[model samples]
Target: MASRRIPKAAGCSPIRAVLAGPAENVITEKLILKPAPETKTEVVQKNTSVHNDNWFELMAINHLSEKLQAATGVKSMKSGYESLVEATAMVSKIYNPKRQQELVIQCLDSAIPKIILNMIKTLLPQTQFTREYFAAFTTVFFTWLIGPSEVRESEFNGRREKNVVHVKKCRFLEQSNCVGMCINLCKMPSQAFIKDTLGMPVNMVPNFEDMSCEMIFGQEPPASNDDPALKQPCYKSCRAIQKHTAKCSS
Candidate 1:
């Protein structure tokens, strides 16, 4: 004899889904409010045996609602199975060991497709700041990192604009697309840092001859600025790099 079922009205939580994340989602937490070394009541000396263990601080970044945070950087896909075809094609191009090796030495703008790099940024922040075996997680986590502006705008056929949903949590102004805008530019840890450490252990790195693809997401029309002189240069850079970097998707 078994019970029928649990009612939908009682207790159900999305926490597990949020925490047991996927390639497309990243979970971040706030840490700005913590006391600095001077303000703290406890002091642990680096080489002293008498120092106390530090407490684990597991704070959470407020979850960006999926719609509010769908990826803005990927190109719109063709209908039906072609979307799968297009995506698979992109993966085949990117996953080459050659590209990965090139990526180790190259900037996000010069090495990889902007969408691929952007998707990586979207998921890793939620990876709990743990270890550096990120390429393993990139396959699964990259897809779940959603962007709100992306989804709403998707419905409008490039005509309908969605009102922003603004929520402030920690230092992240949660609703602004600016967060996504800054994803690669702001969140990137330099390849130099990565290579320096990885070289100590796994020293082998690959080489890419010539890998070129336009960035579909970040490449947009140059944003208008007040100073005419400054405006022209920015417009030129944005336009010139259209051969590779996505102009606008963040």
Candidate 2:
């Protein structure tokens, strides 16, 4: 996969304020409102060009797929992103929303050994450094899923912090096309894993308008009822409505 390098701290850009957290904040959330979903979700699939994934990226994808298989107790013959998505679909089918999220977290816990998580939690104490470091880390390492991204600055506590990752276009979102999958499968689980495992909260703000997103490290996510992302309707081409369909609004 083609990836962009995170620029140095001096090169960080302070863009317009567009983010919200659990607490009241100066920045506001920028979300493109969509029509409310029907009881059924429409899952869509698009034929996109294949990515030239490197060995490391392939290894990461394979490891994650294995972890998901182990968690869901279902084996997949597909490889790369397909296998992971298949496993995720199984997870959505086999459990409630809460349990699905928990199972994904458990998969993450298995994918990443507890020793590393403990070391990170012990060394990084939810400070500005930890947040920025994670932002940069995500930029470098998460390209296999999120596609190319860059580290940007966001206003936090009246100061600019380079703790935001601006995804140019999310590979997962574009591939799945279903907003429900983006939320239940990727967004919610990711936020929970980072906060619970790393001891640093992150709010993943995905812009359905263009499939771009922002990962605001150190910002606590809003409740489900208050989160606009959860309410977003599936794309017109959503195919999940036929396969692995669940409560899209939930």
Model 1, range 1-250, lDDT digits (tens) per residue? 2334434555773332223446567668787787555411112111112212122211111111111112212232443222322332232233342332333234323334667655555554422121223432322332222111111111123443321111112111111112222222212222232323322111111011111111111112132233121222122223212433333322
How accurate locally, in lDDT, is each candidate?
0.25, 0.82
lDDT of 2: 0.82
Write model 2 residue lDDT over 1-250, tens digit each, in one string: 2334554567687444444444655567798999886432221133353577899998999898898898889888899988887777667667777877888888888888899999999999988898999999999998997889999999999999999999987888877666777888789999999898889999999988777899999999999899989888877666465677755554
> Which candidate ranks first by lDDT, i.e. highest?
2
For each candidate, C-alpha RMSD in Å? 28.9, 23.8
Report model 1's TM-score to 2 decimal places.
0.16
